[model samples]
Target: MSAVAPVRRRRPGRARRHRQRHGYLFIALPMLLFAVFTVLPIAMAFVLSFTDYSVIGETNWTALGNYTRIFHDPYFTTALVNTVVYTLMYVPLGIAVALGAAMLLNRRVRAVKIYRTMFYIPVISSTVATATIWYWLLNPQYGLLNVFLGWFGIDGPAWLHDSTWAMPAIVMMAVWAGFGTNMMIYLAGLKAVPRELYEAARLDGANAWQAFRHVTLPQLRRTTFFVSTLLIISAFQVFDQAYVLTKGGPGNSTITLVYYIYNKGFGKLEMGYASAISFVLAAIILVFAIVNARAVDRENR
Candidate 1:
């Protein structure tokens, strides 16, 4: 009986513990870089928002002045309205087009890769270059768009030159430049969908449209959620296209929140005000992301 002592199992060795620590060490550099480039700047901007920093004088803390002014500023209000309208128009249309393209390309057809490459060209292309090209394309007198409109006996609006049509023009340009990425994303989503589900749907007498509605849509729900959320954020933060095309004109009709921030920071030297506006933009984007997440989760359930 005295010889029946139990042997205890030891914990993980020093080597295993060291490996875990080393794995975390590899991530440390990237985390530090992100903090430096992203986190620090956001914090600095938020602090600067409540101040009266200008090129003419030293930065002085002015509690709630910039934010209160934002509420009262007619130009900011106009930009806010324009941004919301642009997001509403762009997000739905972008998703529809991307999903359509993805479905078309998801088939077991020839030359699909080539089509994907062609579609994605605009997404990879530089925004400045694309904007410049579209600037001429939307030109009133001699642009290609108007030339096409002539076939239908429709006169094209002055895209960048007129206040009335400028925001619409921006939306169109953004959709063209941005939709390719989402299309590619959707293609990947479609590929991940199981073939058995489609076969089952077909055997159940579901047509192509019906199959897509019941099977494809459910499978791609996550992708749509991601794509829509990203597109909403990007659409809201739209700046370069408007800047390059209209320079926030004809009479500031195309002046979005980001463009306004740029003007405040660079043009007016109102860095504090610009920072406040930036934080507002961040809040809007966060809310949109949360709403999209909840919608997607509900669909999954």
Candidate 2:
């Protein structure tokens, strides 16, 4: 009779439930912070975009006035054009430089870590500090770049001061400062590529260029897409270099959407207009992101 006593089976569901509870507990703080800081601010900005809510005085509802004014605003139009131009130049050039650097570093060379560190140093450097150094280096008179050009019998332009050269100069500094990051990303992508592909290409009588074109490029498509998307987004938001170096100067040659937003919001105390412009910028970014996602999905399929 004692041996006939039934043994109760423990439920596996209980352990899963306990684990789920603990997981939620672990993530609760981060979720709270995100909701409070990120989500709340965004929601507030959206609401503020419809009102004449300058930092001073009573707020008044403006409906679509702020959004409507953006269309006729010459400064906004100029900023938009400048942003697009910067993007066109920066993205392709940035990707090329990064890919080239990555390829160079991908070799089994001595002191590779040192080289990597040297390239990455600029990325970790303070933006203000880098801008200051670049300011000195780009000075029309006695700047290192112009001095080197002088030795080569090529006269250098006033990079920051000249309207024609301001954007290009900013782009150059941006590419130099930014490509290192994308280079690291590309290096990681290059490392992840199956070595068998290269070997197979060689067996098929492919040369170095042929192997890279057929084997390497195809394998790195996802990486390229990711890098390009990031570059596009960052290019659209470009402000610091223009602000620090040119102040959107030489008749607003380098003024970007973000710099315009800054001037509108803080400089002119037009918070509602600034908020509207920000949302417009956000919409543009969303559209690009969606397009990139669709392209990736189509490629994957």
Candidate 3:
């Protein structure tokens, strides 16, 4: 009988080390960029929050003065209140419209791809373009929105100009511009749902609403959680729309927190106060994110 030769395994030697070195080299650029752009700015902002940092002037340490001032600043209070109100309006409406659109898109129809593309067009459009178009559409006197409302004999409020209606109008515009993305997300989640579940639901004599509530919603809990989280974060960081459309309004009624931060930072050049407020905003967002994640996790369990 011939002697059998045993196979030898490859050792972790120079070749493996060479590959590892190459991999590290590939990642080094991205890591360096992240450190410079993201980490460095975050660190600077945190430190600046405790100092009176003016862009082109002498600085003095303020310790917690900026933070303390936040509590007493009526502008901050108003901005905070407006932000909360915007959140309340934006979150629910955004979810509802997105889900409703998603459900509609989930159907098997001819030209469905075209419909999907049309829905997603707004997402790809520039924020500036969207604001400009909406600015024209919201012209209370000659705008198409009011013109349409006139057909029903409803007196449309001066949308962006009216303090009472300005925020809601902006919310309406944002929802239209943004919901397509969540709809696409929901559509994906809907696709992943097992067909057997829906078939089983129907066999049990469940109607459409019943099936949606029991089968659909349960399967989509994770998706809903994700969508709601994005909406909340976006709602908190809302600036561009208010900036372009209302400019925080006739009475500061639409003055959102981020807008206030922008005004302080660059408008009034109160960099330290802005930095402090921004940190507080970050903290608030963190708390909300934690609560959202925990609530969903508990329910999933």
Summarize candidate 3's per-residue lDDT along 1-301 as a digit string, tens digits. 9989898997899989999999999999999999999999999999999999989889999999999999999999999999989999999999999999999989889998899999999888988999999988999899999999999999988999888899999999899999999999999999999999999999999999999999999999999999999999999999989998989987999999999999999999999999999999999988888999999999999
Per-residue lDDT tens digits for candidate 2, residues 1-301, read 5578688998769889999999999999999999999999999999999999999999999999999999999999999999999999999999999999999999999999999999988888888999999999999998999999999999999999999999999999999888889999999999999999999989999999999999888899999999999999999999989999999988999999999999999999999999999999999888987888789769878
Question: Which pairs clash (backbone N, Cα, C closer than 3 Å) in model 3?
Answer: none
Per-model TM against the reference: 0.92, 0.92, 0.95
Name the candidate, 1 or 3, with the larger lDDT value: 3
Displacement of residue 153 (Cα, Å) in model 1 is: 1.8
| Global CA lDDT computed for model 2 | 0.94
Q: Which numbered prediction scores highest in TM-score against the true structure?
A: 3
lDDT of each: 0.90, 0.94, 0.94
RMSD (Å) of each candidate, 1 decimal: 2.1, 3.0, 3.0
Query: What stretches of model 2 exceed 4 Å from their correct place?
Result: 1-18, 293-301
Q: Give the Cα RMSD of candidate 2.
A: 3.0
**For candidate 3, what is the TM-score?**
0.95
TM-score pick, better of 2 and 3:
3
Residue 136 displacement in candidate 3 (angstroms): 1.7
Q: Give the TM-score of candidate 1.
A: 0.92
Task: Give the residue spans of candidate 3 off by over 4 A.
Answer: 1-11
Q: Which ranges of candidate 1 are over 4 A from the true structure?
A: 3-14
